[model samples]
Every structure is written in structure tokens, then in C-alpha cells.
Target: MKIAKLSLLFLFLGSFLFAQNQKFTIAEAVNGLRSNLAVKNISQFSWADDGKSYYQSAKNAYMVTDLASHKGDTLVSLYQLNKNLDLDKKLKTFPRITFITKDKGYFTQDSNYFWVERSGKDWKVRDWINIDKEAENIEMLSDNEGFVYTVKNNLYLNRNGKIVAITDDSEENIVNGQAVHQREFGIEKGIFISPDNSKIAFYRMDQTMVGDYPIIDWSVVPAVNKNIKYPMAGTPSHHVTLGVYDIKSNTKRFLNIEGDPEQYLTAITWSPDSKSIFVGVLNRDQNDMKMNQYNALSGNFIKKLFEEQSDKYVEPQHPLLFFPNSNTDFIWQSQRTGYNHLFHYNVDKGLVAQLTKGDWVVTEVLGFNEKKKEIYYVSTQVSPLERHLYKVDWTNFKTQRLAQGVGMHTGILSKDGSQLYDFYSNATTPRVVNVINTNTLKTRNILSAENPLKNYDRPEIKNVTLKADDGTPLYGKIILPTDFDANKKYPVIVYLYNGPHAQLVTDSFPASGNLWYEFMAQKGYIVFTMDGRGSSNRGLKFEQAIFRHAGETEMKDQLQGVAYLKSLPYVDADRLGIHGWSYGGFMTTSFMLKHPDVFKVAVAGGPVIDWNMYEIMYTERYMDSPQNNPEGYKQANLLDKVQNLKGHLLMIHGAQDNVVVWQHSMNFLKAAVDHGVQMDYFVYPGHEHNVLGKDRVHLMQKVTDYFDEYLKK
Candidate 1:
């Protein structure tokens, strides 16, 4: 009778727990997030030269809104523009506007080859002559009479009554046009148009040497494999070469930079005079990098302005800024000082001057205002946990905070660098976007002020710094339950993603947390994440300390975090579990496999089982080639350490992950199976690296059930 009463009591609690865990629907959560989604997610907003009006994309058309009057008018339909100058005149009736110009008013068009110019609300068709050619990439360059367009990857000049091909290289491998994925994902456009349409520097990605990885498409009648040139880790990546085309002479010449064929030519930009083009070349190991300059027309190597070397790795993400009204100068961001700092180099003398120096790292280089001799950028200087906008004098390095907020803030300065549009947010405060004056640091107008998660109850998130085994400072965060109790002992879940280019502990409210952490906390689980060594926002040395041993150093920091959590009187060490996705997933599984006694449960999602399975660009920089560093590769492979697995491990992966690939999870699954290790597994069919939409709900529910079953009750 006593056992039956206890069983009834347990049954009631289980029912209540299940009900509580399944309160919100995925659609409801998505809807709520979407409704309160950051309003300042403006992709590309252009202001008029006078700064009186700005053009923004809304719905299907580009709308020009007057900042002074708050009045907006439809400029063009972005979907209606074509390259062959074949635009349907019918699109004009639909308020079609692709892009607008300040001096030329508005540019409107439809998919066919019809472009119209609007002056004072009056529209006039500028180009209506339909030739027997199919238009593809139509672009309006400057306020000049001639417009630049491309047909079948061949650039052309369309003006008055003549259409001339500036680039005749229409071969399959020698593409002279712009590519979407190359531009969007790689954040670089294949085409570079000169300011005055005198020359064009375009990217030519020769994939003829690349081996194609087959992608299976099961949606067809007979599932067929599609060939894609996916350069895996340690493999020969696609060769990218820059080609400069002269519009007047219709001549094309490739820049002759001194480097190996496999070396990466990144951050290609034209000097102020446009006579020379600058290129940063990085070797495969990514340890050595050089900034080379070459004549745009003659293709002659001009000068090697700046060079950087690191014991582990070096990255060339910052663009070389050419100061106006000066002959010998360019700005570069480097981690040579142990932290990412700005440096000015003279082209004539090849002398480098450190512009900004500190322990804080510059997150981004917004731009250099030559007139004021000031450099504006975003950095984590205020506090490593939060990012803020800052302006510094290029000469004296006098720093000033543009947006004085105790949160993650980002801003976009006007074209003239007089005004800035700022967005600020934190874990508790929703994002707010406002226009501010750069000189006075005063806000002009608030574009948006809405709380994304105002309705939902938010957890109390706090930052905590812990010491690693070597006594190095490690930053971490803990998200407490809505109704947190310090007296009760709770199971702890350590969220991790301690990769070189990642930082989990931040002031910004984590979008992935949702009710999941809250649900866990409600079930008496302590959730925490630590930005271990090799994580981003830290100095180059701090980040590269784990080179060749990605998990070794990170695992130490994480274990330190675990020890810190264990020190908390309310933390149940026996019920400790670790969870991570991608790189974090690798670390989690590696931790559990390496130290199984420390963790009771672990979940590694879409993890890279071996470093050999990752992408060449990122993987080679840290772990080198698998052939060269066999021991390092062996150490990175969690499969090799699977024998130490004693925890209840749950492995999850998307069936069609092209990034980490499903093969990684499959290999681990096979290894665990062969080793007679009991493990739980799940796969989201037709999902890629990240599982979203309706399927994500099921995934979260599964994760919740897994953690609740093992770590909670």
C-alpha cells in the first residue's frame, strides 16, 4: 500500500513534468520571435548623397523614404531587372524600382531589359532598344551615360546606340561575371567595376582542377547524385585569379603576384589612384601572409607593403584601406601585437606604425575617415562580454565611444561619415536602432524600439570569469531558471562551442536558448557555457594556443568550468552533462570520451568526428593537413578515444549536412557500434547542417526528453 501511494505520487509528477516541458509549440515560438525579430536587419540601405533620403527594400520594391518628411515612394521592383536590356515595359505599371541614384533620382526596371530614370516623380524609359540578345546582369554604374551589363558572363558597355563587349572571355572556366554564393557566402563579388568605368577587375574561379563531391538528391523519380566541387580538409581548393579588363582597349590581363598556385588571393582592392591593385596572399598553412600591390593594366608586381607571420595561423579578413589625398599609405588590421589592432603603413617607405593598441580586439574595421583622420570600428574594448562602437584618431589614437551602451552595439555611418545608425541590445533589453551623430555622439532618431521577447519570461543571465589549469582568465555565462533556487542541488549542462573562431559567452541574448534552458532550469538543471582558449574575441595567441590540438586546450578550460560548477554547493556533479553543436559538439564528445567519469550524459550534434572531414579553408589553418599531422588528426578524431566513453552519449546529425557532412556522425556511429558502446542516435531527414523550421521543434523536444530522462528525474 505504501509503494502504490509513492508510485501514484511519482506518476502525477511525471505527467506534470511532461506537460510543462511541452507547453509551447514550435510555430508559436517562431511566430513570437518573428514578430519581435530585430527590425534593423536591413541588408543594404543606401542614403542619398545629400543625406536627406534613404532607399530601403520593402516587400518587392525599393522604397525611397525622406528622413525629414517621413514620406516614402516606391522606386523599383528588384525582381524586374535583366542584363540583356530586355525589360518588360509592363513592369512600370507595377511600381518597379531595382535601385536608385542620388544625382539621377530613381532607377526602375523589370526582369527584361527596360531601365527607367525618375526625376521629380516623372519616369522616363532610358533604354528600350531590344536586341536579339538575352540580358542577364544589368547594372547602372555611376551617373554616366553608359550602363554596364553582362550577357553570358561577358561584360559589355551599353551607351547611346552601341554595345561593346569589354570582356570577351566567355569560356566556362574563365567566367567574367558575378556569382551569388561567391559574393554572399564568400562576401566578395566576382566583378569589380572601376569608379569611372575605365577598368573592371573580376574574379575567375577555375574549378577545372577541383574534384566534385557527389550530392544525392532523393526527391527525384530515380535518386541521382549531383557533382559539386567541395574542397574538403587538406584537399586542393578552387584556384581564384583576378583578371582586369580595360573598357577602352577591350584588353584583359591577370595580376602576376609572386606566390604558389594554391595560395589564396584575398582582400583585392584598388589603390586610391586606381593605377595599382592591392592583393593579400595567404599560404595554405595560413601562417604567413603578405600584402602585394600590382599594376592593374601592366600586371607588374608593384610593391610588398605589409607582411604578417604567426607560429600557428594568420587571417586576412580586413580590407586594405587607401587614404585619400595621400600618395604613400594604407591601413591594415593585424594580431601581431597579440590582439587585433589597426596599423598604418606607408607604401613609399614600407614603414608600419601601430595606430591602435590594447588588450581588447577590434571586431571590425568600419572605415577610415581621411578628412577627420579618424578610424571608426566595432570592438569588445569596453568589456570582452559586450561589443561596442568606437572611433579612434588615426594619428594620435585617441579613442572615443560613439554609442555609450552597456550591451552589444553595432552602427552604420552615413556615406559622408557624419551620421551613424546604431543598434543596441543585451540579454534583458531588446534591440533598439537609432540614428546618431558621429561627431557629437548624439542620437538623431530612433528607427526601431521593440522588445523581441517582451512577452516571454526571460532567465537571469550572468557573466563569470574562471581560472584555467594554467591560471589563465576564462569567461563564461550561466543562465538561471526564471524561478531559480540556490538551496536546491541541480544537474548542470555545460553548453560548448570552443572553436578558434567562436565565442559562446556574450551579453547578447542567445537566440537558441528559448524555453529549452528555462525548461531545464525549471527541472532543476544548471545551464552554463564557457568561452575556452582558442575561442574568438580574444588575442591571436590566446586563440591559436590550441593549434593542432583543438580540443586539448579547450577541454582544459571546459574542465575548469566544470570544476567551477562543481564548487557551487547547489550543483549536482553526478548529474553533470555536456552539450554542443558542430565544433562544440566535437569538444563535448571528445570530453566525454576522454574523461567519461566526469560526465553522466552528453549530446554531440553534427560533430566533426575527425579534423580530416572539415573544410580546407578553416581546418588547414588550425590542424594543418591530415597527411602532415597524423598525430594531431588522430587526437582530434573522437572515434579513436571512444573506448573511454562511459557516459550515456546521445549523437544527433542532419542527414544532408554538407558543412560537417553526415559521414562524420556515421563514422562515429559505426565506431561506437564496433566497440560495443551503447549510444543513442537521431537524424533529421532532408536537413542540412542546421535543422530549422517544423523539424527543429521535434529536435528540441527530443533533446529535452533526452536530458530530462538522464540528467533530471
Candidate 2:
């Protein structure tokens, strides 16, 4: 009897102590992940050229550690870098460094590029170059010979110390050396340097035919109008062409790509010998693609390597990766098998072999091992929610998993593909960085990040899985209120972004998914999130289910989540709330107006009210065109459904948003007024798309206040 009494007393004391722990403030919940509550990590972690050592930035210094001995030494300090550069005011931190060799690296400070070399027990700045302060989209040559940059609407090459004008187009409408196609089709940069460093290929876009749109800056005395070229769906788009500039001859020529001017040119690649270029030419309808090879010097079409066609759409996002030492064969990433897989193609023969095949997709290709004929890549073969590292033999198609973690794993391979630097995180693990020997599968943990929220009164998070109407397994997370009581009912908030190219339910740190969700849970609200069918990383079939009709299938999956939530005895079904941003914002608005009796409150930011007003690249790829699918657009458009809204809806938008545009919300307001419907609206002046930085705390606070006012009441 005495021992049992003592046990009860100790248990009471432990519960009291746990309840006294910290709780996240609105500001902390909004920005703590990047600041006070940030997980400790090895900053700028990279592998050495030899794969025997690795480098990282720490304590304002760059350090390298040997993998065999696990011994570390400081390579360069901020003091040495500042002293070598002769800066008037010392730099506060070490600049980001990229290693070209074991002893040579380069870093940029301000507009100056500094190349450094390892000296005797120290480092010294060997060479440097200064470009214009206004230069954008800078691409440096691999050999450190020169760089290409764009100023305003032209391209310039800085070779050694000489600056040459590569393009001198006068019209701003005809932009040179910049990303085109609204930055779609996996095109991130405009410049591509050849292997031999003798030629440069860049994109030149002419947007004179595109419609001009104005973004107003109300901060000025009399609001200033900034004009931007915007191509709506089924409208004329910017014309893009590839241009090659020969460094030695100082002459430029356009590739002989015969197609519609507005057709997309993606998957740019250079032949190993630097004498040929390959491009994936996609038509404006985005249903057909052709891989064509062209002569580099003469700008002549060599041959059509291959052709891919799809009844829906053939979207090629990755460039063709050539073999290490051969130009006759290359690896192509395609969704031909309903999943993104690797296909080996030869220059003379059509298809050599399929390197990888499965229901899962290869997320990224790290590098190749020439001697062993192997390729390193990241894939979802283990599970759709987790990413793992694997290496495959290109010759025989035998694959082996390298990392032993059940989470999202990303890696950097060494020069010979013998070592892999694996970095990953899971629900319980904040972060872990490991160095693994590919041959032996021996692992060494270099970093194990401590949980940043250990002291906080965190809510109990659980993984929830439900089957869709078509019996597809859908993953979700539910964060119960702090010090949960199963007997008492709780209000629920479903935070979701059920759109393309995004997956919310991942095996990442903080099982609550987002910090803001955890914050709301502490305030006695249950937070839930799920990845619907339209989300990415599944396969072509799962994603294409929402084709032509954007919100129908996704809504079916979300309703399954709703059914699961309502089935729980502790859920207060009448007080449910919803929130999302961008594509998520569209989802939130769609749910509120379509299912008026389900949710009681919603906060949507930067919602796409109409698909016809969106940009051409993304809009047409999924919904075709307004003229092509009028009924689909009419059904998805929120303007006609304004009268059906019965919830406490708060719509937010960035006044100068260029991505979704401010008109999406403004037009919705006009329609609501015309239809005699009432809703709350807010605007963040001088902000774009999403409200970020310190002001984000205010935005989240407003959202939290709305939930507290309506749902809690």
C-alpha cells in the first residue's frame, strides 16, 4: 500500500512538470524553424573530389574531415579570406565555397568572384574577377576560364579579363539569356556550357506577342504600374529559340529547330565531344515530343533521335544525362511506364535498355560510375512516403539500396561513386547525416541533430491512412490537442495543399507536419492534413486522374479523410475549419463553396478563382484550354459558386502577386458582390504570392484569431 501511494505521487509530479513546459507563441510558431528552434546541421556539407574526405562550414571557417580517420582540420578561416581580399569591413561569415578539385575552390563576395588555392598549411586567393553589380543569371565556366551573365535584356561573356558582348538586343520585349516557358518543364536556368568549354548555349525569348499585365505599387505617391508579360491559357505565348555562341570564332548561330515559335524546347544537352546538341521539342498542345540532335558549329539538324507521344500529355522535365566518357549513349528520364524511370538510348540504335522499372519513380540521379557502369539515384521503391538511395548496374539492371533509413533520403556521390554522403530525416528524428561506403554498406553517423522541441509541450501526432473511393491508399496526419482527452470533443482544422507537384504527408521531422499546426493544437484544436490523389510522387495514373477536371477526384479523396475524422468519437464535426495557400488556397475555397454544410470556417490565401486567368504553361498542361474544355472550366470556376458559400470565409492575397495575380481574388470579390454574397477579405500591400518574413506572423495570427473566434465559440 505504501509503495503504490508513492508511485501515484511521483506520477502526479511528473504530469505537473510536463504541463509546465513551454508553448509556441505566434511568432515562434511562424518563424522558429529557421531561427530559434532550427535543427543543428552541418552547413554547406559537400564531398571532396577524391571521395576520401568531406568539407563543411562551421564557426566562420571551412573545415575538411577524412572519412577513414574521422579527423578534421580547418581549411580556411574568415580572417584569412577577408585579409586576402583586402576588404575595408571584415565579412561576418564565410562565403559559400564550391570545390573544383581537392585544393582549388571558388567563392563569391558581393559582385566579385574569388578563386582560391590551398597553400602550405593555409589558403590564398589566386585569381579574381568583378562583374557588373546588376548582373543576373550568371553562369560560370567549369574550367574557371570565364563566365556568362545577363544585364537587362542582353548577354555578355567575361573571358579571363576581357568582356565581350554576346548579344546586344535593344528591345526589352526580346529578352536574352533567361529562363523561358514561365520556368516550367524543369527549365531553371538559361545558360548551358559545353563540356570542352568552347561553346555556350542559351535561350532567347521574344515576348512581344504576349499580353501585357500591370502590377500596381500603392506605396508610391501616385501608384506606379509595373508591366509584366503574361500569357493566358489558349493565348499567344512567348517565342523561344536556342542560340549557340562559339567562343573562339566570336560568332553566334541559332539552332535549326523547325517547330511552332511558341512550342517548348526543353531537356537541353550537349554531346560529350561538344560538337552536337540535343533538345526535346514539345508542341504547344503538349501531347507530342521529339528528341532532335543538331550540329553545334553549322546549326544544322543532324537527326531525330526519338519521338514520344501521349494521348493526355508528354511532359519531359529532366535533361538527357550522357555517359561519363562516351557520346554514343545517354540516359533519359521519362514517364513512359506510368512512372518516371530511366531509359538508356544509343545514338545509332533506338533504345538500348530500360535501366530502372517499377511502380515507383526515381526522384533524382546523383551521378555515374564509368568504370563500374553503375548509376546512383534516389527513389520511392521502399514506400511512396519515403525516399531511399539506390545504385543500379546500367549493364545488367541489378539494383542495391545504399542507405538504411526509413525517411526522405538525399545523397551526393563521390567522383568514383564509391562513397555516398546521405542526409535524411523522419518523424521522430530531426536530422541525421551519414557517410556510407557503397561497396561495404558501412555507415558512420557524422551528425545526429537533437530535437529542438523537446522542451515544448508538443501534441500527440499519429499517422492516419484511409482508402479513396477507388481503393487507393491515402496518407494523412492528425495532431491531437495538447494533453488530449479522448472523452471530450475537440474542434478540428484540416490544413491541406492537395495539388500537383506537392506532397504534404511525408516521413519528415515533427509528425504534426507543420509548426503552425502544432501551434494550433496547443490551443485546444486538433490539426489534420492529408495528401490526396492529385499530389505528386505517386505516378502518372494517380496524378492524371484529375486531368481536364481539377478538383473532382481530389475532392473524393479528401472526403474520405473527412469520413475518417467524423467517425472519431472525440471530433466535433460541426466546428471543422480549413486553410491552404496558393493551390491549397484554391482547394480551401472550392471546399467551402461546394460543400457549404461541412466546414464552418476557412482561410484561403492567393487562391486561383479561375483557370482561364492563369499562365499558359501550367494551366494548359493540366486543363488544356478554356475553348477546349469549357464545361470543365465552368464547373471548377469559383465565381459561379459564390452564392453557395455558407461558411466564415476569409480570403487573403498579396497585392503585387505575380504568380497567381491579384485579380484572382479581386474578381471573386466582384462576383460575390454582384451575387449578394458576403465574405471577409484582407490584403498584404507590397507583398507577392505568399506573405513571408516577419510579417508572416501577423498573417498567421489573423488566421488563428478567426478560428478562435468562430470555431471555439
Candidate 3:
């Protein structure tokens, strides 16, 4: 009787454990991210501030190793961190720790700041009130020095326990310490600190001049009008100015840049001495840009280094990269020769030499090694589909490959650039992180992530290469449905975003780069995505092939993909669907109008129906101005071609989309009504550009259902 009771108790424990572990669902996968379903990964692997030691992190623990000795020890214990802190909530894992000095480290638990100091056999923690609770984009200089943050729409500097307001503007339209120019020219942040961190420079965008676009809130008792600052094309744009703040004086001064107020202020950079600041000031027309520098203290214009002008437009995405320990020479990224390459420039000597040149483009510059006079970067030197890390020696300008195997490899270099923590992922490999000693070229494997969705009904994703109309090589990825059979035919779903600066067909894991594609594959749809002409990472010839004709070449190239899809024995040509977002949305509509009989169904999200309605920077770069290229605008406009759309097309928007604007879709609906074209429409309330978060599952479900109802015959 005693043994039977013990067995019953064990069975009860097993049932309780089983109840706690729930099976993953579609909603759980989309919303919760099924955090428990994520692949076990190396949490935070970084070279310590000392440069001689590095740390590899886990959930609750971290291991630090000395490079010279290859000896490692537990650096921080989350258990100890929790014990030292007093809080209402108990922490589960280690915080985001950043080592400032040899002994001091700072971390954050949500928004609360914690500074931990190392003692002999114990760790001491303290709660500091130097940081603002409402601060955003906090860039700290040191442990106790100060930090720069933005609250609401203004800039603030919290220094040595006192918070100083930089911009006291009460208007939300006057945005400070944020990226401007609709996020073009690679302006992601408004804050740029000096090397010494004594002064801070930030962008001040005054969008009060722009028009207000109102959006309604249907979810509320009474729909309210929420107006957004939208600077449309061929209209009055926002004026931007660069301001510098001195910590000692707590004063602000704007740079004396000579240009129209509505012109673009991009590629913000600081001198090594912090005495000067540089900016790429483009004109209102955006066809020309003057790379100029100014005095940081006096706020006076220094000199114009160089100028770039194009009949179409000149876009400056990268900033000035100064040489290590030297301020005289710097590297600049330009696409003057129809290809983006690196150019070495001397402030006094003018253009010294072009460091890198070829048909390929240098995607990103990692860092520079001062001792060895080498700079590391990732480029499309091998192939446009793959990105590999390479080191270019400054002496001879010879390049050496650093990354092993294929796919996109990105790395974080040490302060001295002698060591690197490399991270990579590909279609086959889930993830692989490594530590490399640059001097000896010796590398050690740190962590390799396993396939997280191994238990799911994954599809067979493979890379497909097809030729464009002009015989140019186009790369694409196709997902065969789970339990795919050769005898039975399957419907095709052409998923694409065949626009500039986006290459969907990459050697990335989950092979399609989106889990939604696999989810649709589980529903038995053969998904396809290709990077046609005018897509990024390829040479300028390929990307600019659609110049003056945005949707023409991309559509024709996609037709080549369709021709290849029809050639496949398992593909059903009668039931075909197409899906694209933004530029892809533009292409999807264009294909339906151009082909007519090819696609049976299509779904477009936030697509640009007319180039004139798009932003100035991006639209003008390819199609020039609406005033100049009226024919290109007329040809690409889907508004007039609504009569040609034979497929069942569905256009979805964020309702308040500021990028493409809702007017693009609203205008299309007006034309559709005039032409009496039947179509489907949906909108996600309070969404902009794209419908994200948990609601995105609903968006995809709506899209899947549209194709299922029409094409899944």
C-alpha cells in the first residue's frame, strides 16, 4: 500500500509539470515570440573595456577570459546582483552590463540604473539618481561623468547628478535629438558625442512648417483626430539645424551652414580633437551636396571639403571616418563611379587616393586597426547575395578575407582592433559566433545556435537563380510546402520587395527570412521571393537598371520568375497569387496591370501608387522630380491603370502611414471607383508604415485568407 501511494504521488507531479508546459500556437508564436521556443544563444559576447579580456554571457551568469592566457572566470553572478539590490520585484536574469573602467560596471534593469563596484570577494551595488527616468537614447560617457538623453521632444544632459535642459521647446513638432530627413542618408540618431565626451552635438528638426495629416481612432467611443507632421513631396519641408552643447557652460550654438532652411543636413561627424564638426548639406532640390566642416566652438563655417552633384540626385549615407590618432586624413563613402566605394581624403592635401574600387559595393566599415594600419569591412566582393568580412591594409590597400564559409558575417572589434568577436548566420547554419585574434589569424568557435523551429512543420527552402529579361542574374528563394508531393500540383505565392536597397533573397536562416512564409507553407502554398533588377547590394548597373522607370523593369523581371515558376512541374499556373509591401506593393499592382492574366490574386501593403506622392529624397533619387519626369510618373502611376487590374487585388494600409501616406491608397480607391474596378481593402488602426506587434498576426491572417479564398481552389 505504501509503494502504491508513492507511485500515485509521482504521477501527480508528472501531470502538474505537463500542465505548466503548453504547446506553442500561431498566436503564441506571433505575439509572445514563444520566448521559451527561442534557440539557446550566447547572450552577450563582447570584448571588455580592458581590450585584453572578453566576456561571454548566459541567462544568469557571465564568463570573462584573458586573451593572452586563454584563462576564463565567472565575471558577474546575477544571483549576487539580485542579493545586493533592494527592490519590489525579484530579477530573473543578468542585466545589460557595460564595464566602464577596470573595476566599475553599470547595468539597467528595465529603466532603473544600477552601478556595481567590484570588491575582493564581494560585489557592492548602489542606486544612482543621475539618469532621468523618462530619458530616451541615453548615451553615457562614463560611470559618473554624465549622460545625454531625450525626454519627449527635447534634449537633456544629466551630468554629475544635475539635469540640464538643452532645448526648452514645449511644442511636439519641434523634435530634438532625433533622426530627420525621413530617415534617409542613414540618419538613425540625432546625438553625436565628441571623442572626449565633453561636448554633444544633435539634430533639431522643426517640422512645424509641414502640413498636418489627420487620422481617426475608430476604437474609441468617438473617433478623435490625431494629426501627424507629414512633409509631403513638392511641398514645404521641415528645416533642420545642427546644435552643439558644451557641458561646462551648458550653452547651445547652431552651426553656420550655408543652405536653404528646408535643405537636408545629413552625415553628421566630429573631428578627432572635437574642435570641428562636418555635415553633408544637400540643397532643397537634393541634386547636389556640399561636404562641409565647421568650428565646433565658434559655430562658424570652416571650409567645403568637396561637392557631389548628379543629374538625378546625390545621396550621402555615410559620414567622415577619420584615421586613428590622426585628424588630417579620413575615408568617405561615395558612388561617384556608379558604384559605392571608399575614398581616402586628406583635409590639407585634398583627395589622397581611392582606397577601394570595383564593381562591388562596400556595405559597411567595421573599424580600423591603428597598429597594423588596416580597416575591416563587409562587402559584396564575392557575390551580391552573400556578405563577407574583409580587412584592407592601408599600406598597400590589399584586402584579406577574414570570414570563413558563406553567408552574412558581422563582427565587433576590440578597441585596438587586434581581436574580434565574429557573428554569422546563413540559410543552412542557424548561428555561429567566433573569437578571432587578428594578428595571428587564429579563430576559436564560441557558440553555435541550434535550429529553434526544429519541431515545427518546416518547409524545404532552397535558393533559386533566374535571369532577368536582359539576361542579368537574379537571385530568389522558394519554399516548397511541407509534405510536398511531386504528383500533386501546388499554388504559387510570389512574395517580393523588388525595390532599391532591399535584397530579400539572402542566405539567411529560416531560409525565407520570415516565419510567415513557412506558416503559409504549412497551409500548402509554394512561396517565392526574388531580388529583381533595381534591388540592392548588387552593382550600380543592376540597381540603377530601373532608373527613370521604377516599376517597369522590376515587373518584367518578376515575370521571368513567373515563367520559371510555371516551368516547374509541381507549380499550378491557374491558381497564382502575389504579395508585396511598400515598393513591392507598387510592383504587385504594376504586375497585375501589366500581366493581367498571370496572377489570379495579389495583396499590397503601404504601396506607392504614384511617385509624386512619395517622399522627396528617395523618390527623386530614382525618378527625379515630378516636374522633370512627368512621363515616368504617368507610366508608373497605378491610379490610371485600375481598369487593367484583372486580378483580385487587396490593398492594406496602416491608416496613418506617414511614409507612403494614406492618400496614395485613398487616391487609388477614388480611381477604382471611377473605373468601376472591384477590389478588397483593410486598415489597421493606429498603425504607421507597417502593422507590427500582435496585430501583425491578424494582418498576415487577413492576407492569407484573401489568397486562400481566391487561389486555394
Ranking by TM-score: 2, 3, 1
Work out the TM-score per prediction.
0.84, 0.96, 0.91
The numbered model that scores best in TM-score is: 2
Predictions in order: lDDT: 0.73, 0.91, 0.84
The clash count of every prediction, one per candidate, is 18, 0, 0
Ranking by lDDT: 2, 3, 1
Better of 1 and 2 by lDDT: 2
Residue-level lDDT tens digits of model 2 in 552-644: 888888989889999999999999999999989999999998888989999999999999999998988888888899988998999989999
* Model 2 score (lDDT): 0.91
The positional error of residue 169 in candidate 2, measured at the CA in angstroms, is 1.1
Runs of candidate 1 with Cα error greater than 4 angstroms are: 1-24, 28-32, 36-46, 52-99, 102-187, 325-328, 445-448, 510-516, 519-524
**In candidate 1, what are the lDDT values of residues 1-713, reduced to their tens digit?**
99999999999998776654443343444333554343345545666655667776677566777766678886655343222234553343344344446424334333324455654544454554343256555565564455566666566667654777767764554455555223311335566676566787876666667666666666677887766556777777767778888877878888887667777777777776768888878887778888888998899998787788887777777667766666568777778888988888888887567887899998887765556888889998888888988888877878898876677888776666776677777776556676666776667554555654444545677678998777879988787765678887878888889986677767765433344665566555678988888898888767887888778998888888888888988788899988989998898899888888999988889998988877787788788888778888888888777778888889999876788878888888888889988899998877888888777778877887788889886
Instruction: Give stretches of model 2 more than 4 Å off.
Output: 1-20, 82-92
